[model samples]
Target: MADDPILRLRGVHTHIGPYHILHGVDLDVPRGGVTMLLGRNGAGKTTTLRTIMGLWRAGQGSVHFDGRDITRLATPAIAQAGIAYVPENMSVFSDLTVAENMRLAARSGAIDEQRLDWVFRMFPALKIFWHQRAGVLSGGQKQMLSVARAIIEPRQLLIVDEPTKGLAPSIIQNMISVFCELKQTAVSILLVEQNFHMARSVGDTVAVMDDGRVVHAGTMADLAGDEALQQRLLGLSLAAHQ
Candidate 1:
């Protein structure tokens, strides 16, 4: 239902060794829309994504996805539940060809031709470099390959961290176009991004975290229109960031 959240985190706390990261993070990712997670550096944004992927175990609270509790589930099990994660590093196998890296990401051990065609439509560079080694591709092409791998199989949720971190302006624009197209597919996206332009353009919902807690949550339009709120929560206006 549109009223129900696809993913929910309630009073979630996470610890990395002795250092506590997420302090009672209460968040909701609505079904079939992009929910952009924004905050200043060290605001626990990345940790939050890691926690959701089971890279960091939540010390307290619950993570609910598709109406099931997944707080303590193993990483592979959590992934099996239909959540695909694309970390900041764009973890593509450098030594392998783009096709090989994509083939590995398929849980079924075989690529779906129709899905592959769809992905190519989103990122033509991947199709152009199908047989090329990942290490030889430029930064933007590598990022596209990484995303291609994630979407090679059907997924209910896609979580990405700083996908535009080091890309050039043109590449960022391409990514924006691709994400806009992905949004039309109706797959929920929990994106951790510092690029305010990308966030404003693609985010349907916005959540601002500060000091390990969600300090603000609302429609992206609301946040985008309020320069004062943006400054207070993010320490700068989106316009300034852009």
Candidate 2:
């Protein structure tokens, strides 16, 4: 692993039954920054994030966090090792109040109060809706709660999948700001996003995945400077955002 690379995956091959999804996926999430994973739907972006989180076993290859091999670790063990995963759906407890959900995520006193304070500061909306059931909150609110839960404990790495999906543009902007702030902390972020404009806004480094392989990677500036590369890989043009 490279020095200070918080998360790294090398030639990872993960298969679900007879269907192989991740084929030689290589990725790196550096410390104290956000690395965006961009791809078209069915490009295995979510699956790659899942594999990194150890939600499923990788048939071949190694996953490293803080310079330790974690490929064979169980999902709960991976989580206990200071990696947190916030899925595309923002998995909130629908039946539980916002406060209840947060308390439950603390893992019976394993979480840090200072971390919770930071998350609440980042998302004052969550503090405001503390008594409401997660099911009753709006989509953007749920996203905030999901993020809050992830930060309930002081984690070294954070993985977020499609966090902007179904959110209003205003909410997306707020989320982008939160990500920017999170990058200032020690926690590294690996994000899977189909939203190009948002990805461009927050991605320090980018890896474009297609057909379960990382086809392109570099600094965000590299991706932004090449219009042809952007158009070809993502079917996106910055003109559309203007």
Candidate 3:
């Protein structure tokens, strides 16, 4: 392992009821790069993200960030440590104005004018709807707000789960651009996505999960070269481009 991996998980495991999810998962998220967790629908990708966020505590292994062991920290404590999570549902406050919603997101000395400017630059549509209520915004707009609000502070690492899920092609394109631009700020991103095209487009490293375990880990280029492995581990029905 490197001297300072932004985030690392070793032998992580989780369960719901009697069903165990993660089976001694190990991952190293490099600083200022995108690492995508790829797998089929039931492959425990979401469970891995949840464990990192403290929403699902692993019974074993350790989750470390910036050389500190955070596997036992509470969710709020983890969030205050500069980790932010953007779930797939895009849960924005429906009654609040966009500015109001963004203000609320700015927590523990997080929200600032510079952050606002960066978010607005990524999604000009958010600027247009600054005064509107969140409930009325389209799905794409809501997703933008959900992500932008989280970034209102200096999030050392951002975890987004299935961001492009159920979105229209146009909206998906827009989201890809937003995420790509965000990398310019040098924020490490741990992305959980099933969409092969989107993952390959933004991910620097790719890990394939199956049956609650990480079976393959490598750079995006390496994953692209292994067609049989992609099909077997990820069930990728089509060819993936680098």
Candidate 4:
């Protein structure tokens, strides 16, 4: 069904040790486009992504992906169900070569030549550093490699946490281009981003979280065009960032 959400969270609550991070977060990530999750610091945006990936278990409520209940699934099981997650740290193997890191990401332990070629085309720097140690790459290149590993093979959903954090504007623009291109492939994306420029550039739908709950949900264009709403939800206008 074209209108069905690729991922859905209903009345979700998450507790990280003594503190409860999410309070009944209800979000729907519609298939085939980037859904940007935006909020101020301490909004539980990252916690929501972690909970969805099974890194943190929901204390209450349920999560559904592809119309199936996945609230209780393990992290690996959630990943095996055609989802890929790129965390904020860009966790590439420091001691391994770029090629080796990518190979490890492949479920079959064999890199698909065609897919590898596509990734190289999207991020030419990866090809340049194919044999270089991942630890030696620059911060931007490491971020690219993290994304490359996630998409080394096909996936139904790609969840990225602040891919542009600490990156230069030029590098962030490049990452945005890759994400825009990825949108054309009909793979659903759930992105938690503070970079308003990157969010507005790649997002089709937008959800704004505040104090562990989603306070706004609508098309990105609507929020982008309404400065007052942006100020009210995110504390600053998207225009100010542009």
lDDT of 4 at 213: 96
TM-scores for every predicted model: 0.97, 0.94, 0.94, 0.98
Tell me the TM-score of model 3: 0.94
Clashing pairs in 4: none
Best by TM-score: 4
Cα lDDT tens digits for candidate 3, 1-242 = 33478999899989877889999998888898788888888888888988988988999999998888999999999998989999888979999999899988888534677768878888898999999999989988898899888788878999999988888888888888888887788789989976677887788887888888888888877777678877787666437432
Candidate 2 ranges beyond 4 A from true positions = 1-4, 108-114
Residue lDDT tens for model 1, 1-242: 13589999999999999999999999999998799999999999999999998999999999999999999999999999999999999899999999999999999889999999999988999899899999999988989988888889989999999989999999898889888988988689999999999999999999999999999999999999999998899889888867
Please report, in order, the local distance difference test score of every candidate based on alpha carbons.
0.92, 0.87, 0.85, 0.94
In angstroms, give how far residue 14 of model 3 lies from its true place: 0.7
Give the C-alpha miss distance for residue 56 in model 3, angstroms: 1.6
lDDT, candidate 4, 140-207, per-residue tens: 99999999999998999999999999999999999999999999996899999988989999999999
Ranking by lDDT: 4, 1, 2, 3
Candidate 2 lDDT by residue in tens digits, 1-242: 23568888899999988999999998887787889898888888988988888787899999999999999989999998999999998899999999889988887756566777778778989888899989999989999999889878778999999999989998888898899988888888998876777788888998999898999888887887788988999887755763
Clashes of each: 0, 0, 0, 0
| lDDT at residue 214 of model 1 (Cα atoms) | 97
Model 4: how far residue 45 lies from native, Å: 0.4
Query: What local lDDT does model 4 show for residue 49?
Result: 95
